[model samples]
Every structure is written in structure tokens, then in C-alpha cells.
Target: MPTLLTRQRWQLLTCLALLLALAAGIGLRAPTPPDEPRFVLAARAMVETGQWLLPHRGSELYAEKPPVFMWIQAATYQVIGNWNLAFLLPSLLAGLATLWLSWDLARRLWNRRIAWWAMLALASCLQFGLMAKRAQIDMVLVALTTLSLWALLRHLLERPNTRLLWVAGFAAGLGTVTKGVGFLPLLVLLPWALWRWKVQLRPGAALPRARSLLWLIPAFLLGTAVWLGPLGIALLNDPSPELQGYARELLFKQTGTRYANAWHHVQPAWYYLQVIATLWLPGSLLLPALLPGWWRRLRRGDSRYWLLLGWALLVLLFFTASPGKREVYIFPMLPALCVAAAPLLPGLLRRPGPRWLLLAYVLVLGAAALGIGAQLLGDGAWAHAQLARRGMPETLLPVLGAWLLGFGIVVLLLAAWLRQRRAGMLAVLTAVLLWNLHGWGLMPALGPYSSSSALMQQVGERIGPSAELGALAWREQNLLQADRPVTDFGFKRPWDEQWHDAGPWLAQAPHNRWLLVLEQAISPCVDRAQAVMIGSANRNRWWLVPGTAWNAACHAELSKDAAAGVDDGD
Candidate 1:
């Protein structure tokens, strides 16, 4: 047993533990709202329509993002033949790759011990764990960004290896194609130049020539060309205004305009400071101790810390400058921070202060979980109200409460057994346990309500097989989970326009045709007495409208709104 705990064995065990934690709840739930369903719907369309170059949502082209992530999903689905598993696999694989890259980079920069610490720190981060388990593009983008950073660091610090330089360029290019910010890793050049000017180089170490760096342009271009090249040709060859509009929107508006003046999710400059404190928690709790030490190193002109910390700061500043902000935008910088902090974690963990903090954090988390669980089980009014508001069945309250109680009890007991002496280990254990319970128990329980699967299922049952369904102001989840074919008025089109189109469709076959209309989207012309209320999902009430519910008088109103270009809602 002692022999089994060898260094190699421990590393393997760490990886296996990470995998198990990340893979816990996959396939148990369908894709939920905000972003998951949209991506999956696009991927499914790709597989079904054989239209790999462009992604379509219902009838409209989805130009908000590049097709690379969708392509990965489509490819994964083709091989596995399971949408649930396939949609999530890319993020999982990207997460594992990210962990491996962080481990390897730390080992190369410092040693095996530090590598272990880096991987563990990154894995234990709440944001990292959250992104890893979801089918999101940010995780994949993080993986690519980390890969570019890893290669760039090696090339700049270790040796002037051209191949590594090309690797860095290509990865960033791929990162750009994945999402526009892929070129962020190249920002390291500024710090690298500053370090060269400020610090003395070790014997036989020298910076690469200016000309050698030029290779990055082509490499990066090659990466973007993977998606852009095809898109450009398609746009040029086909004179269709829709494709041209998609190209223009994707190339310019989505990338630059959105960043410069974000129309949604706007936040103040200091918002990320709050995000870094909370979302990056447990790991972020160490910052108070780590920052001073890092500053000391920077003051002494330590090039390693300069490069890693400097690049991370630049990435933060870059995102902070943007009007549009999201926590995941800075996720790529996490690996670099973990690597820089890894060598110091072992020392920090030995100190009593960090240990007590970790212990306290664990206790608070466990207590919160326990308290929330007890509240639900005791028929707390707040708990029941929350459940009802989310469209979750009241029957699930006991089961959810039991699961939370079990998690809390186990976590609290483990913290007690480990005490402060092994609080660092306790922290990792707590994270694993929390994620496992979330994935295996909590997420699956929330699946029906969260994914709108229950709502769609109920819609199917009420309408019967013969009824044709059309949707007004429909979400991606509604279309994805529908039992049969669904006709959706354009997703981005105005609610009035959608109502204009849906009214006539419902009027076509009043007896057999039904319309699933959003409560807000249902115009005053529709008769509420005839429309049946469908349960809420995704925070919106839906109504099943028969042809009898449609007032033909409303058509004149809808036409006037459409002709006037009066956009009521998105």
C-alpha cells in the first residue's frame, strides 16, 4: 500500500479524482437555458441538415459566435450517437486537457510537487469546476488559451524554439476562432520584453529575434482561417444577403461592437474585483497571503513571476476595459495564476493562518447546506415558494432536502476528522463531494424544471399527436425538447412580428393547430378565456392557444406594428 502511493501513482490518482468529480452528472440532464440549449440546438441542426459551415437556429442563421465549438459538438454527437453525452464531452475533455497542461507547465517551470499543487488549486476553484461540467465554449477556449500560454512561456523563457513559437501562434489563432479573445496569450510578449530590459539573462539564454516572432502572424492566421477562410469564400461566392449579413455580424458586430459597447450584461469596472473574490473562492481565499509574497518577488525582479503574473494582470485589465463583462471571460488567466501560486501553496498550507481559514470556509459551507436542507424538510414557506417559482414539483422537496442534508453531514464530519492539520486536503475533499452531489443528485432533480423538459412534455400530452404546434417568442429549450416538429417565429425577431406570423398559422387550422405563446408575447387580441395556461419554465409563463383564442381583429394591429417597425420585445 505504501508503494502504491508513489509519486507517479499519486499523480494518476489525482487525475482520476478530477475526472470522477467533473464527470459526475453528465447525461442525467438535458441542456438548460442562457447558452447551453442554443449551442446544442445549433449542433443538432448541423448533424441533421449536414450544414457544417453555418449554424442555424430554427430558420435564422446564428451569427453571434463562430462555428468551431458547434463543430466539435456535432462531431462528438456523430461518434457517440447521444446528444446528452456528446454535448458535454467537449467541455469535459477540454477541462482534463487544461488540468494536464497546468500540471505539465508547473512541473516544467518549477517541480513535480508544485505541479500537483497547481492542478489541485485549479480544480478546486468553484468557477473552474462549474465551467468544466457545463457544455460551454468558455471551457474549450480556456483550454486553447492555456495551451498557447504554455508553449509561449516555454519558447520565451526556456529556449528560442521556433516550433514552440509556431505552436503558440497556432493555438492563439485557434483560440481566436473559438472565441475572439484567443489572441490574448500573445500579450505575454509585452512582459517578456520588459523582463529582458529589466533583468539579467541566465548564461546562454537569449530572446528570439524579431523576425522569428513574425511566424506567429501566419500561424495565428491559419488558426482563424480554419473557420474564417471557408466563411469568407461562402460569403463571396454566394450573393445572398442573409449569408452576407451573417458574415458582417460575426466578423465585426459580435467581436468588436459588442465588446466596445455591450448592449447587455453591462457592469462597472470594479465588478470583476467582486467576481474574483467570490466566484474564484476557496482558491481565492489564499490571495491575501499570496499577493504580498508575489509582490515581493516582483520587486526583486523575478522574471518567472513577472511573466506569469504580468500576463494575468494584462488579461484582467483587458476584460475590465470592456463595457460587457462576464466571469468566464477571464477564465483563461486562472491556469497562469495557479501555476504562479503553486510553488508557494505548500509553504502557505503549513502555516496555521491559512489552515484555519480553510477549515472555517468548509464549516460555513457545510452549515449553510445543512441549514438549507433542514428548512426544506421542515416545510419552510420560503423553500416551498422558491420551488414553486422555479416550476419544480413539490414532491422533489424532500428528496432534494435529504441530499443536501447528506452532503452537509458528510462534509462536516470529514472536516472534523481531518481538523486544521489537514484542512488543505479537506478543502479538496469538500469540493469533490460538493460537485458530486450537485451533478449526481441536485442537477438531475432540477433537470425537468431547469431544462423546460417538463413544460414541453406537458405541452405534448395536452395537444395530442395530431395537433401541429407553433411557438411565439420561443426559447431554444422549447424547440429542442418538443415531441414533434415545431415551427418557431424567428428567435431574434420582434415579438410583434412573431405574433403577426403566428396568428395566421394558427388561423390556418383552428381546430388541430395550437400555438405555444409566451405570456408577455400574447397580445391583448388573444382571448384569455379560451387559452390554457401552461406551467412556467425558464422564468416565463407559456400559454397554449387554440385557433378559437385568436381574434382576427388583432391582425390589423399586428400589421400596423410590423409596418411601423415597432419592436415590442426581443
Candidate 2:
């Protein structure tokens, strides 16, 4: 086996390179739809409008989540003025924290070699690496959850550090604001309860100190108060129905309505079980092969395995049991999974069959990349037709070409590692670095239709950046794309053949000149002769309406609000 110092410099260099790549393109891609725009817009609102306590999406109260993640993003954006950097820093840092937590946990459970191997294995995890750079809640949540576990596990191993027990709960509490699932750390108590009920710890069993659980509550509540206190003061001082409703939506509805009766991303109970294969990647392949080894460890009375496995399994079961499932929901458990699985890697890789198998697995992965490139950049009419059927853009050809080259190089690198079997772990880390490049570099082209950032910049230039804009409906991407504040003209219904209906909603404005941006497809059917055809981006068609007649009745209400000294709610 390679000692702790074997190829240490190369390992450090590769890990550092991967970190740079992971943190490379925070602001590169347009903020994606469904979740990102809302989060991005909320952070932008906080920075621009100074509503740090309350997060607003466009002109409406956004309480889908608490403001911890948004607060960090907003703080970053405020200093640097780069939206991508602001939006993505939390995930990147959280990913780093999770990796360190994994390394420490491995070192505690086994040794330094296992700890180093664990960190590398974790960095290469397909899901963990992706979330690390995304403008999403999962990565932060995972980090906090992992940190909490690591702290508590440290306390268990070294009873002198009782302070870590409280730290665990506090991280969980902060996690709660990051996402509803922030309370995952509190779940650690379940296993302790189980152990207490069934098994008696020997004198030096390194179990949890009994009194430590008491300190966790205050720390958790204190973490929550960071957001809750400010939010309360803001809402209490200036009460509004939207703000009130948002509070309920976040605290309860997001948990209850979204949990029991989720409106979006409702997947099967077995959904996570199916996605686990993709999430763990090469490590996942070794999982099945390592089962006997894991079972042996468990049987040998090493209670640490039980603790780690129990924590990960409980998280998996908790999310899987929920009706609302996303692939990302299971990500928090991955760090623990890596640590738990780290011990088996040294044994498996020392064998010839496992090394050859890993090589073959990577070979298949490379061939898959080549095939994707062929379909994307090649003159395969059948592939073009297939992609066209799925509504992909022809512009993706070049993007795919770049990804193909990157993957091809990674394949060659993996082959070299295969030839030099001692560098097996290097191959995996390098593969992850390549994967990061593909995801971060080529993401813009992957989903062309969703984000309108590039197109919206052009619109902003033509209409003047300060001009306030509004969307006809609730496609929230406009808020992120627009340079100015975008009022949501909550649509009565989507624009259709009778598209004139959207005119009133689209035309309503606090600003005099109304720049109604619509899909190019809708413009042809919507009679644009009366409006000035100002500009168009790839697929977004823009028109300027002179009269502020969008939603005329809303205009009457606005007049009343002005007379009553009531500023409009956004």
C-alpha cells in the first residue's frame, strides 16, 4: 500500500487543481429555473434593496426558504458585485467543510491514510462535486449536516471534547434555515437512544456523554434566531398579508404542504434508491463488492461503523420516506457514506481485479462521453433529429465538442493511471476534475432555453439598464435576467392564441415605458403592429408599449395606494 507520504505532492496538487476547477465558474452560467432564479433574485433584492431580513423575489415576498443561504450569497455579492460568485460561494465552502469533516471522521475511525483516501473518494463523488458549485440549498445543508455529525462523532471518540456535542446541534439549527431539513443533525440522538436501550457500553466504548444532548437545544434555537429575529422585527414593524403568508409558507407549508402534498418534484418512494447508482459513481460500484468487508467490520464489534451507517441510513430513510424527493436531498449523507466506505477502498484497490474493473468502468464512461459528443457535434442526422425532437439547440454542437475533448483527455489520463496501477486514486480524482470542467464549463449550453441571462443583457442594453420591467406571468427567470427590478404581473392565465389578454398584465408598470418581453413564438400570434419592436434575444422577443394599460384595474388600486401613503408591496 502507498504510505501517507507516497505521491503526496501530486495528490496535493491534484486536489488543489480540483478545488480551483470546482470554484471556477460560479457566475458563468445563467441562474437556472424553478429554484435558482428565486434564490438569486432574493439575494439580489437583499443587496440592491437592503431588505436583508426579508427576501423578496421581484416585488413579492419570497419565504420558500429562510435567509441564511441568501444572506451569505447577498453578503458575497455586496462586496464583490458578482452575482455568480455571491450565489455559489456557500456551496463551494460547504463542500470544502464537508470534505474536511469526512477526512477527520475517517482519521478518527481508522487512520490518516484512510482519512486522505476518504477525502479523495468524496471529492470524486459525482453528486457531491456537482452540488459544491451550484446555487442551491442542498450543498450547504449537506455541509452543515456533515459538520454536525463530525463534531458529535469527535465528542464520542474523545469524551474530553464535550463542546462538540453542542456544536453539532448548532450546525443543524443553522442548517434548518438553510433548508427545512437542517434539523437532520438532531437525528443523531435516535441511534444514541437505540444504543442506550439495547447495548451497554464498556468502560472505554467511546460512546456519547449522556448530558451533552441538553446543550444542543439552545444552540439549535440560537442558530435559528439569526434569521428569525430579524425577520420578526421586519414583519412586526411593517405588517403585510404577503409577508405574513410567506412566514407561514416557509415555517409550515414548506414542511407540511410540500412534504405531505408536494406540488413539485414528487417522485416515487424508491426514487433515491434508483438515483444512488449515479450519485456515488465508481465508489458505488465498489459498495457492492465491499459489503462483505463492511459486514465483517460491523460483526467485529466496532460500534463506530454502526454509528456512521445508522446516521447515513436514517437520513436516506427519512428523505426516501418523504413523498417529495429530489436527487439532491440524499446528498448530505454522501460524506458519511464516503467515510464509512473509505476503509474498504485500500483493501479493494490493492487487488488486481478491482484495479482492472475500475479501469473498465472508466473506459465505459469515456466511451459514453464520446457517444454523446458524436450525437452532439457529428453529422449524424439521426442524432440531430433525436436532439431536435427533445428541443435542443444547434449551438450546443460546439459546447459538446469542448466537453468531448475534455472527456477524451480524461480517458487518456485514466488509461495512464491504469498502466501505473499505483495511481488508481489519482485517476478517480482526475476524473472528478474533468467532470467538474464539463459541468461548470458546458452548463450554459446544456440548458439553453431556461436561463435568459445573455439575452436579457442585450435587452437591458437596448432599453437602458435602469428601466423597470415586468413579466406577463410567473416564469421567474425574467427577474434574474433583468438588470432592473421586475414586477411580477401574476398572470390570470398564460398567453395563448387570445394573447391580447396578457397585454393588460404585461403593460402594468410603475415605470412609464413598458418593455414587455415575450417568447418569440408568442410575438407572431400576439399582434405586435401596435407596439414598437424594440429588440430580440435568441428566442425572447421584446416590445415597447406606450400606454401603462397592463392590468388597468391594478392601476386604479395603485392610485388608491399612492393616495393612502402606502408603498406598493414587492
Candidate 3:
């Protein structure tokens, strides 16, 4: 291993390079759908109104998520006076912070080589790398959760300090405010605490005093109250039944209803198994080979390995059991996965053998890259058509060729470097470099298709600043991109009965109003004209302009589509 990569010398430079790559071009493009636009627009609304407690997309209350992440984004926007970097800066900073904390944790638990390798495993991952660069809640939540766990685990390993425990609790509470899964570290702590209490209650077993919980408990409550208190007061002062309903929904329904009986993105228990195997790709491939080593360590009466495994399983199984699932939901456990996997690399690359593990990894990746590159070169339009089917932009087959070629070169270098044990780490470094290049170079090409900004701008030019804009079956990005007051004509959530009463209000709105909509419905829609197909991203096509009328044809067509479950696809 290079001593230069260790904290004693070149480590800071390496970290800076990594951070630069992660933060670079974060502001270069507008956000994409589903999560980013919604959160960013809500933050924009928050900044506009200075109402930090209740979030809004436009005039409607946005109850999908709590406001900790939004608050950071809004503050960033306030300071920068623009939404460009502000929307994604939180995730970037959080991800870099995660990398640093992960390095320190690995250094404490193991050696310098293991620490560097652990951080590389995380930073190089397909899942973690992408999430860190995007404007998403998962990265922030993962960062806070990891920090809380790190503090608590430090106390668990050696120093039995009440202050560390308190910090751990406070961080965990903030994590909760960040996302619903924020307090999961406390689950790991609870078992450890009970085990400690059990052992401490007996005769002295190399330790006599039980850990203090006095400050830890109170700190956690206060951290939660940082947001909850304001939420309650905001609801109390408003006296609106809708706000009260939002309060109840945020507290209870978003937890139980969204988890046990999720309204969207439901998946089977085994979904994460596939996601972890792929998205954590090439890194997680060693899990099968690494398990026996962990088992042996446990058999030798070393509890650390099992503790890490338990923490990982706690995250994995919890999300696995939930009816709602996303690939990013498994991210909070990536730290443990990286740390636990770090030690196996040294043995897996041992020189006494033919280095089968390294060879397999290189060959698999190299071949995969070659296959993609070949396919793109031979059938460029075929790939383009495939992306078109998914409502994605052109694959930029030429750029993909370059990306794959570069990846292949790195894989070849990885194969060559396997002659030396220290060079084994190059595989991970190359992966990270390839991902950074892809993000900085190729991914931005899709921005036109991914963002609604251009369409919004075009419409803004036509309608000017005074006109009211609305969207039916539209995304939040349209609202964020619009300069005028925008209305969400789509039903945000099934519980949002506000849409049920939308007909009269929508019909009564100003005559100069224009609504943007998806192209699939305009055939049956009312008075549709000059409806330009603007762009496509993630299986949806957005249009520049679509007209609406308070006629039976429009209502009948909408009602029929609603009955036919168009909302399910939209």
C-alpha cells in the first residue's frame, strides 16, 4: 500500500480530489423528477414565504417528507441567491462528510490499508456515488445515521463516556428529522445496551460501571423537538383542518401507511437482494467469500465482526420487510458493508494463489465494458430506440463508446497491477475515476430530456410573468422551472382529497391560464393546440403547452382515463 495515501501524507490531497469530483458540476443542470424537483421546489417555496415549518410545492402543502433537508437547501439558496448548486450541495457535503467519517472509523477499527480500502469501497460504489451527487434525502439521512452510529460505536469500543453517548443520541435524532429511518442507529444501540446491562449486572467482567443514559435520552428528545415543536405550533396557529390533517399524516400515516401498505413503488422482499448484488456491484461480489471469515472471527469469540454484521442486517432486514422499497433505501448500511468487506481484500489477493478473485473481477468488468461498447458501435440506433422506449434521451452512443473504452483501459490496468499487492487497490480507484468522468462528462448530456426548465422557459416567454400556469398529470419540476404561479393539477397523493374538489376551482380560474400536460392524454383532452412535445425522461414525456376547457368532452375523457388508471402510470 502507498504510505502517501495514508493520513500521514497524501491522504488530504486524495480526499480533496474526491471531494472536488463529487461537488463538481452539481449546479450545472436542473434537477430531474420524482424526488429532486419536488424537494427543490418545496425549498424554493419555503425560501419565498420564509415559512420553514410547513413546506409547499406552490400553494398546496407538501407533506411527502419533513423539512430538515429542505431547510438546508433553502438556506443554501438564500445565501447563493440561486437554485443551481443550492439544491444539491447538501447531498454533496453530506457524502464527503460520510467518506471522512468512514475513513476514521475504519482506521480506528483496523489498519490504514483497511481504512483506505473501506472508503474506496464506498466512494467507488455505483449506488453511493450517484446518490451523493444527486439532490436526494437518502444521502443526508445516510450521513447523519452513519455519524450517529460512529459516535455510539466509538463509545462502545473503548471509552465509556456519557458525552459520546449524548452526541450519538443527538445525531441520531437529527437523522430522524432527516428521514424516517434516521433513528435506526438507536436500534443497534438498544441491543448493545441491553447486552451491556446484562453483563454489567453480573460480577465484574473486565468492566464494572454501566454506561450512563442521563444526558443521552434528553438530548435525543431535544433534537427531535427541533422540528416537531415548530410543526405543532405551526399547526396550532393555522387552525386549518387541512394543516392539522397534514400534521397527523406526517406523524402517523407517513410512517405506518407508507411503510406497511405503501401506495407506490412497492416491491417484493427479495428486491433488495438484487439491488445490493448489482448497485453495490463488484464491491458486494465478495460477500459470499467473505462470510466464512466473519464466521471464523465470531467463533474465536471476537464480537466486533458480528456486531458489524448485526448492524448491517438491522438496516437490510428492516427495509426488506417493508412493502415500500427503493434501491437507495439500503444505503444507510453501506458503511458497515464497506468496513466489513475491507479486511477480505488482503487475503483475497494473497500471492500464494493465482489471485482468482482479482482476475475474475477484472475479466468480468472488462468483458462487460467491451460488450456494451461493441453493441453501441454496431447498433447505435438500436440503443437509441431502446432509450426512446423508456422515454429516455438518446444514449449518446458515441460518448458511451468513450466511457466504455475508458472503463476497459482501467480494467486492463487493474489486471496488470495485480502483480503487486499494493496495486490491488487500484481496481477501486479506477472504478471511482470512471464514475466521476461519466458523471462530469456523459450524464449531463441528458439534461435537456431530464429537466423541464427549457419548456418552462419557452412557456414563460409566451405567457409572460403575469399569467397563471398549471399542469395536469405533471411533475414538480415544471413548477420549479416556471416563473409564474404554478398549480399542480395532478393528485399528489391519494389522501389529498383537495384534487377531488379541483374541478370547480380549475374551471373558475383566469381565462388567460395555460396548463402543461403529458402528451398521452391530449388526444382526448379539450381544445388542445400548439402542444409541443418538449422532452422525455424516466418514461414520461412533458409538453410545452396544452389547453383545457370546462366541457363535457374534457371531463369525460379525464374521468375515463382516471377510471382506466392513467394516474397509476403518470
Clashes of each: 0, 7, 0
Clashing pairs in 3: none
Better of 1 and 3 by lDDT: 1
For candidate 1, write residues 517-546 as lDDT tens digits: 877677777898999998899677899999
TM-scores of the candidates are 0.96, 0.84, 0.86
Which runs of model 3 end up more than 4 angstroms from their true locations?
A: 1-7, 190-208, 351-355, 370-379, 390-395, 413-423, 457-468, 493-511, 521-525, 528-537, 543-559, 563-570
The TM-score leader among the candidates is 1
Candidate 2, which segments miss by more than 4 Å at Cα?
1-7, 200-203, 206-208, 234-239, 382-396, 416-423, 444-450, 458-468, 491-512, 515-570
Ranking by lDDT: 1, 3, 2
TM-score of 2: 0.84
Pick out the ten consecutive residues of candidate 2 with the lowest summed lDDT. Answer: 561-570
Q: Quote the positional error of residue 438 for candidate 1 in Å.
A: 1.3
Worst 10 residues of 1 by lDDT: 561-570
lDDT of each: 0.89, 0.69, 0.71
